[model samples]
Target: MKPGLELGNTAAITAKVTPDMYAQFEGQIVHRAYSTVSMVYHMEWAARQIILPYLEADEEGIGGGVTAKHVSPTAGGDTITATATVTGLKGRAVITAVEVHNGKQLVGTGEVTQYVLPRSEIEKKLASEQAK
Candidate 1:
């Protein structure tokens, strides 16, 4: 966390839907629209961007938790705008409210929590695990 990190800080990103974002796998068509997994990833991307600039040089944001819903289908070639707003802070964690829209339609919404950790601490933990 850093000074000036507060509620209402927002970040938004836009991306055009593509074949890869659709719910097709193994050449099987489960659906012909944006997937819930894609919505979660895009939502996290927007939330992370909002929290990054406030982190210290030694700190990195990691995904903590996310609860999301896919409410509507987004066709390929349609552009979606994902937005995140900081709503709360718990110690070193940031709580963000996220939403996705395709033009005037609401496609998805969620709450995401991101934890800021020292990069060195993560590497140290990995090294300790590897040593076992």
Candidate 2:
């Protein structure tokens, strides 16, 4: 990490719902509404934006955990926004609180945690897991 990452920092991404984002399982569409998977993906992207400018050349942010809930349905073509706010930072972990909204309606909410580690350390961990 570089410097100046602090709580209350926020980032957001807006996207229009599409067929591909619909709830599905094993290639079968389960619902015509936006999926929890897509919501979480957008949430992570929004959170990642907060750390992008602060990461050192040798540091990378990896997903540590995610907690999400799908509270409302958004149909295709409805624009949605996922926003992330930095809520905590401890050691190498950055925690964010996230929300997904369609206009004034809250579609979902979640928390994301990311771990900043040296790229070499991450690669070594991957290699060891693969070797196992």
Candidate 3:
């Protein structure tokens, strides 16, 4: 965690729906609409923006968890916007509230949690797994 990180800090990102973002089953349309999973990616991107400017060279934020609800369907070519607001911080944990919209209509909402840690610590953790 770094200074200037506070509750109410927010970031927003926009993405347009594409054919690849739609749901498919057996190469056919499952619903012919943007997939809920794709919205999750946008939500995470917005969450990442909230902390990127505050991170040190040796520090990084690792995603911990996300929970989202899709309330509406979006067709391909529709522009979607996702926003994240910092809601809380507990030690190394940073929590954010996320929302998605198509224009002004609310399409999704979520909570995203990320753990702030040292890059060296993560590298060491990966190395430990290789050592085993």
TM per prediction: 0.91, 0.97, 0.92
lDDT of 1: 0.90
Per-model lDDT: 0.90, 0.96, 0.92
Per-residue lDDT of 55 in model 1: 84
Number of the candidate with higher TM-score, 1 or 3: 3
Best by lDDT: 2
Highest TM-score scorer: 2
lDDT for 39 in candidate 2 is 95
Candidate 2 has what TM-score?
Answer: 0.97
Q: Candidate 1 on 1-132: residue-level lDDT in tens?
A: 678889899999999988889887787768778888889999999999898788899988888899998898899889999999999988888999999999969999999999889999878977999999
> 2 or 3, which is superior by TM-score?
2
Model 1 ranges off by over 4 Å? 129-132
The window of 10 residues in a row where model 3 has the poorest summed lDDT is 23-32
Residue lDDT tens for model 3, 27-130: 78787688988999999999999999989989998989999999999888999999999999998888999999999589999999998999999889889999
Tens digit per residue, CA lDDT, model 2, 64-98: 99999989999989999999999999999999999
lDDT of 2 at 127: 100
